[model samples]
Target: MSKKLRLSSLIVGDAQADRVVPPTGFTARLTLFAAGAMAFLTVFALALSLASGRLAARWGAELAQSSTLRISAPAEQVGAQTAAALAVLESTPGVASARALSAEEQRGLLAPWFGPDLPIDSLPIPQLVEIVETEEGYDVAGLRLRLQAEVPGAVLDDHTRWRRPLERAAARLRLLGLVSIGLIGAAIAAMITLAANAALAANSQVISVLRLIGAQDHYIASAFVRRFTLRALSGAFVGTAIGALAIFLMPSAQEDGGFLTGLGFEGAGWFSLLLIPIVAAVVAYFATGSAARRTLSELT
Candidate 1:
């Protein structure tokens, strides 16, 4: 006959071992509070990273597929050169559509820096036209050569020189946010380990009774793991909720021009935010279990 497995043969040894759980040992309640604070900060860091990534993708997509043509001939030849440039762009295979910006539109574009009325027409300003392209974009080298040969004083600015720097800055911000989350996670694990060791040291007498009664190593580890994991889960839950609320209460994109003001989770990104507490709890479980087993093994 096959041997039967006894689920009820409790490995905890002493049935009353539950009564020995101490209130103050390793991580004080203060440790949980600190962990919660760190988790909260991590939530914001994650949101910032995600938002910045989205912004970078949007900016890159917009700028990559667009180009600008500047017509800088004498006032008399301005119209002729602009027309010639438009004709060339229209004939170009990659170009989608070329548009010479209207005077009012030009004024609006400059209004942010120079105020509404800056004597736009009276000054000898170059004519500017916008070129929208297909997904493959256009051949800037070839187009510039064509413009130079056919339209004197014409220059093409695809905005690449300046756009690349903005993309890099956004990318760096994203990396910073990710690094912050990693550091926060590490801190949480360290705190849990310390807390478990403290609890084990404080309850030395309880551990002695449990071991004297034949408690398995797994049972001793479980006591510490269960307590620490529960604490971390609860703390992280409250922190995540508070962090999410704080982001929601902050000024939105419609209210602020500064990008920092609107930094937050958006759309389906909020769903991923829910995973933080679960991860914190899992980390605490493993950290506390390992610490307890190692410390107990020394005594054994």
Candidate 2:
């Protein structure tokens, strides 16, 4: 109990021992640069993860509860089939709304491929009807049966093939982003550990003198731990702030950047990122303390 109290005091309460040890410029810069760089990369990784999640939710919400009906009958029958499909959809229990695409809308959809001048009336293009599902989506099998009976030429496109792949890709991207954050954290810990070890080796004489003066291992270790901890916190804070600003400066989602361009933090994500500096400081504290104690244990 007494040992733990003394150790705690040495780590956070006392400062004389820290002043006794001269700071090494090289290790100081190394720690600052490493922590800053790692924090910057971590911010991006976090953004990627958050953005991917948003994309997945958006795609699922937009595509999951809707279906398309295509009527490819002869030109004479197209109008009748489209009307029949819309009527069936309107009468369907789980369908919220259904509308047949206008001539202008269909032409606009085809203009991308066939050029603006392509005559819509001349082409025997299939008529398209968009169907929106209610809170309880339509039963696919039942809808298929109704369509087959009422409109032989109408085909349902549930968008399942398209949606599944996009959702899976977004999920994978999110997973990759999380893995990247973990790697950045591990890299930061490793570099800080190496820096701490180097500082310990450089201050061997100081350690010897302090030990001879009746200092405990925790007291000796605290000096290095506190220095690295503060350095990491300061560096990480600056890095995170800079990163956040960079993200803020990015083109807005309204710019039509699709998936990758929309990468950035949302409401609560910003709050979570604020914890990076604290996490870096904690990691540095433990890493430096462990290195210090291990190095001190090997001394004569």
Candidate 3:
């Protein structure tokens, strides 16, 4: 539309209107600082959201496909119950594989709590069996019933208690990260709006002179919108770059390092960071435009 083209031209460069707003001032610095700081925070928030999502998926998939069986019996019956549990699991439909952990493996599991030198044999440690499930996963209730009848000491743990809580925690963390990003965006908009209002108020004398010279309100407002939007875009770009660099320089994720060690983008995830500046620009466009128009109307 003709109106759209005219507006775009004004934003692109209206030499006459560009002079209306001072090129550098306190408002300019405020808009730049707010956008930059918020964009930096937005990057971290996005990283946290992505990391939490991956963590949730991993916990859901890994835990759902696996479970544990603990056998607590008199020293004489421990081996018998463990063997019986393993046999039951092997015969169960939908079981992919099952194995009774060796004494050494069990010692490794307990080493963190009891120390490596602690003699595992001296303790009445319950035998543990690891079970992996097929895509159609074994029926937990049925499996429990079978273990009860054949292996009296066997207790089946489908990891339901552990999995549900972990998944819920990861999901809630992801939600919180997303909410943080939204709040950051709103904060940026608020800051830009305030800066725009301040800039407009400071230039009322110039605006009055321009109005006397027949400058349309839309043309005057467009100059302020374009300037503030560009400032936001540039500031956000710088902030995003710095934040991403900081993330990249962080220690690489190691399998042993756990979730906290991997709080950064992975592969395609880096591309998502590029949107931060663009989003900031759009937020500024609307915010500054609204503030400019309102301030201009009040001035008249």
Candidate 4:
């Protein structure tokens, strides 16, 4: 920005000869490679955060309007308690449907723990009824009170005891993923700064010669800044494209045991992912630019 530097940037040199402080060389390539690698990793992390966020929302929504009624009475009274609980649920304004599990269905559920051949009929297992609620959701407290009076052996479980904590844990995982992305960006900035500083240090003699020939700091800095910024921008785009493709190629929800498939973004989120290149470019611009200006100012 100094007048001395302005004169140097526009000072025409040899028309056919190569540039004095020519475009970045090996260092730029290495820096770009590093940046790209980091960006690619960050994209996956971002996808994980976004996917987790979606999963948490869905799980929270699905658990909100459902409850389970358990009848733990003696064998003689289980059927009566289950029927009474179902009757109460069906009569409630917010209740959509209430149905007691059939014997086969109950046995199938218990089979997971009792093995495939357990005699469920002989076990002192409680009978369970599934309750579905409408949009407003049922008043669980009131429903419990009603169940206690007419079906003393029935217990209402709104699924809140475990649902809320699961949701919070999912949400926290999403936040942690986002924080990881932020740290990656910060690391990129720091790496770029170091590379820029090294480039500046290496070109001290060239800078002095340019200044001696009526060149300014801006000209010298612009050359380095433009090269680094472009490299970062290009590398980031390539990385983002690769990263997005990787996420796109991930298995569907039904595949890969529900782990890798859930590690990417969906829908319009890809557009946001594309912005990472621009952000990387901007970071490079500021980092390289600031470092150049400060270093040059100290000399001339």
Candidate 5:
């Protein structure tokens, strides 16, 4: 349409048209700094969103298919109860597999709090059993009833109480991250609009002369729009690069590091970062153009 043509012509601007806007000033600095700062924050917001999403999916997948069983009884009865519980689980319709944890494995779990040198054998620790579920999953109520009847010491923890809250928290964190990005974009647009207005006001004399020479309002507005848009694009590119570098330098994802270390781009996720600068430019284009047109109309 005519609007696109006007924008395109302004982008491939004439030297004379470009001269109307100052090459360097407060407005230029404001636009660049605003775009850069917002873009930098946006990168982190994007990372947080993606990381939380991955975390939620991982938690859902892992927890959905697995559970734990604890057997607490007198030292002499522990082994008997564990065997009874295993027998019950093995016959359960939806359970895929169940294994009692070795004393070494249980010791490893307690080591973080109890220390590596703690004498696990001397303590009356509860027996732990890991349970993996079939695709259809086990009937929790039925399994719990069976354990209660066959093995009084056995306790089934499907992780429902634990997993639901963690998954919900991760999902909300992802939502918050997305909301932060939207707010950042709005902040960028507001800053660019103010900068455009200031630049237009300062160049009122130049605008008058251009008008007197029969330059159309659209042509005059395009120059300002194009300048601000390019400034936003350039600044955003720099900020995004620095942000990505910072993320790249962070600790690599590891089991020990958990969620914090994994807050970064992985594989194809890196490619999405490239879109930030382009989005910033488009936002600046619309913001500056609207500001310029409104200011010019008022001047007339």
Candidate 6:
């Protein structure tokens, strides 16, 4: 009761008390290493989340706005079917434009498989017509029915077969990134709690002396909280800086134009990384406070 009154007085009287707990090197290093490691992993998780989001948006927008038409028929009927498919697409309400791909364009698409010197004219390859949709988009079922009725050889493909899988993959990647972040937070909390427990165990004499000298539980806990929180903040800062530098050094998106290689921050994403240290500090503060209070309460 006397200790509580003294603590209340310390708060209300705005008086500073002398530090009662001596710091241990082990807990300091442990907290620093744990916070730094977690923060480093968190940076990569954040990058994965942001990059997957961008990929999802790009795939949705690009794939949703366009479709393809493949016309397979006899040499004489290929041109007529292509024309008929174009007419059907043009008269459609939601379609923005439909143009048959030229021979050169078709040959270029097939070049990887058939080689550049392969004679495109000798082969009876299907004619491909690209279809662009308006902002409102087109009725895919209705367009397919119209194409079947007008041109039997014409097949309208909305690219749904390919787009759905890509979208699902991107969504799963984003979810994985989020799960990683949650796991990282849990790891940080657990590590900080262990470090706090170790510190409390090592300074049993110091805690007993403070209690014998009329120190409140909050006072003792606050000492541990402040020390661990500052350590976590400093460690997270260093880790975040190193992670950001590593991300910056990664290959640019323009270099290879690959999704996995372009894993890094963009625009406001860089600013979001600044919150990592603050979050680490808060986590440390709460984790250490809880552990310290529990340890102190268990003492005589």
- Residues 245-290 of candidate 5 have per-residue lDDT tens digits of 9999997888746888889998898998999999999999999989
* Candidates 5 and 6 compared by TM-score, better number: 6
- Say what the RMSD of model 3 is: 3.7
TM-score of each: 0.80, 0.80, 0.79, 0.77, 0.76, 0.82
Model 4 lDDT on a 0 to 1 scale: 0.81
Best prediction by TM-score: 6
Q: How big is the positional error of residue 300 in model 6, measured in Å on the Cα after superposition? A: 4.0
Off by over 4 Å in 6: 1-18, 74-76, 115-123, 212-214
Better of 1 and 5 by TM-score: 1
Task: Give the TM-score ranking, best first.
Answer: 6, 2, 1, 3, 4, 5
Candidate numbers sorted by lDDT from highest down: 5, 3, 2, 6, 1, 4
Candidates 1 and 3, the one with greater TM-score: 1
Poorly placed runs, candidate 2 (over 4 Å) = 1-13, 73-84, 91-93, 111-125, 145-152, 212-214, 251-253, 258-261
Error of 1 at 42 (Å): 1.6
Q: In candidate 1, which residue pairs clash?
A: 26-198, 26-199, 27-195
Tens-place lDDT digits, model 1, residues 70-112? 8898889988888998999999989999999888888888899
219-287: candidate 6 lDDT, tens digit per residue = 778777777877898999889989999999997888538798879999999998999988998888789
Q: Which residue pairs collide, candidate 6?
A: none
Candidate 3 C-alpha lDDT tens digits along 128-188 = 9999999999899999999999999888899889889899999999999999999999999
Per-residue alpha-carbon lDDT of candidate 2 for residues 104-134, written as tens digits (9 for 90 to 100)? 9999998999999998899889999988899
Model 4: per-residue Cα lDDT at residue 289: 81
